[model samples]
Target: MLFFTVFELVAALPYSYSEDLARTVAQLGALAHCSPEVISAWSCPLCKKLPLTNPQPFGLPDFNLSGYTGTMGTRLFLLFRGTEPESVINWIEDLTFEMVAYPHCEGCRVHAGFFASFKALRGQYFDRVQQAVSAGKEVVVGGRSMGAALAVFAVLDLARTFPEHVRVSYNMGCPRLGNQQFADWASKQLQIYRLVHWNDIVPHLPPRTLNYRHISREVFYDEPMANFSLCNDSG
Candidate 1:
């Protein structure tokens, strides 16, 4: 497989790559638990840009790892929910800080509790992604905040099974998901784009003091103007 460092990839981003789509996807991920009727009514470039319709717009009913999914054009989206009140409680209650090397991958260590929750919920959406891929469709996975953290885990696992099928991932205001080694490894394997807001304090959590590190290729924006600046490996 080929790998581009964060700097190289960002430099090559096309003008047509649509930051608007990225923001919309992030919003969808943040609202994963919202009702289907609301989700359907909310217009986004996913359908307008791609000219596809959602045959099935389903969201995970379980509160713990609730996520939303839908079909748009030849792309399948798997979006995870962010830190709601219950998720915050989970973060506080499960404060063991245990780190284990991710299975089937070398030199990658992740938060045990987060990884466990992601693994449990992943199977629920993985099938749909696989089905879409098998039918020659692209798969885009993303999330915001805590859901962004979970989405990273999902992409790491999914890449092993559907390398070519798994396309870009949009992580909005995501917390650090793993250690330096894991970040480096995941960056090389996936086209992961992290979006961070200047005033958004959530991305700074789990602390690097805990040995957590973010992946490469960040699109940062702030304040009055949401114009984005691309960064590499570092926020």
Candidate 2:
């Protein structure tokens, strides 16, 4: 199969990375791992200061996949948590890497596990995100690890519905979510910042040899918590 990176898939566009937005969304991604009560209460340090409102957690009980959605000022935010290290089900889902057709786009396929996880609870939060969009709110979706993979699906779906309204997505330590077609399709849809921290092995999972490819605009950090470099989409 022919592979297409973001560079070959889409035209060059003006892109800028914001440290503040990344930090805030990173906090939100962490908060996604919290309980419903903690999410509703906005108990985190950053949450205490941000004008985050209408926080609600959604998930599938069987899979233990969960996340929270809320509005921060005019931005509608959806955040998903990564794999639960202790949950056998989550690990099972993460390991199930069979690629399947992504229904929302033609010739686009994604990780079966991530797509299944997204489809399970998509209804629970999709309507809320739509409502926010109807009110003219910009959309911001994020997640970490497996959740970041899910965020890729969510943002692409949202972009399909309200193309201009879906602004940006912040995915930290995210693995490759789909095939070349899907990655190419997603790159044209919105701004996807795939943040890779130093030596995180999770991002390399499922193997590129299996035809799975990551989306555009990779932000790679060399040190543990310090500096980072914006990588090209050649891989």
Candidate 3:
């Protein structure tokens, strides 16, 4: 949509998320749309000069294939994206998959307001997914680092907004982003998968929150190689 060409989309990304990271993420999104695969819909924002409680944060998920079609409907695996220098750019692409084609259900768009949620508009974004699943579509959710944390938030949102649509969520390298009480409450309601790379440091930055079931790992040897990291290669 907004970024028409592959090059255009890659160029629009922050320098921290590298072309490699963006490319890989794009591939991941594409692959996820396949039969029984996981798809991602990232919508994160970063605000340097805004208040922490600002109603509209400005981090984008940088997703691809917002207009996925299988003659079967749409299946998704959403990733929130973290703050690594390399993969941040990729996250941006995931968010803006296709300005014109970005997923929408009624008035319930991807960006469901920070203070406000489309919990009331459950079918707007997830109805199609449920239909697909009903017809038998395999969907999965995930994210890396902060993306993983955001994935957690998304599922909780979906549970509250559209409890019947979601079945499972697997987040990666997530480091707790919600309140302890809320986190515990959400964890009890859904099937969440949290994946972490080997000794991921970015996740530790904002300080992990309390609550929610978790899974961590230390598998990588260095950074930048993880370009699709939250930083988005500009770093």
The top-ranked prediction according to lDDT is 2
TM-score of each: 0.80, 0.87, 0.41
For candidate 3, the TM-score is 0.41
Ranking by TM-score: 2, 1, 3
Worst 10 residues of 2 by lDDT: 1-10
Tens-digit per-residue lDDT, 123-199, candidate 2: 98988988998899998999888888889888888888888888688888788888998888788777888888777
Higher-ranked by TM-score: 1 or 3: 1
Best candidate according to TM-score: 2
- In model 1, the worst 10-residue window by lDDT is 1-10
Q: Which of the two, 2 or 3, has more lDDT?
A: 2
C-alpha lDDT of candidate 3 relative to the true structure: 0.36
Per-residue alpha-carbon lDDT of candidate 1 for residues 108-172, written as tens digits (9 for 90 to 100): 89877778878778777777887888998878888877788888888878878898887578887
Q: How well is each residue in 42-107 modelled by candidate 3, as lDDT tens digits?
A: 222212221111111122124211222222123443433334556655644443111111132222
Relative to the unseen true structure, what is the C-alpha lDDT of residue 130 in candidate 1, on a scale of 0 to 100? 78
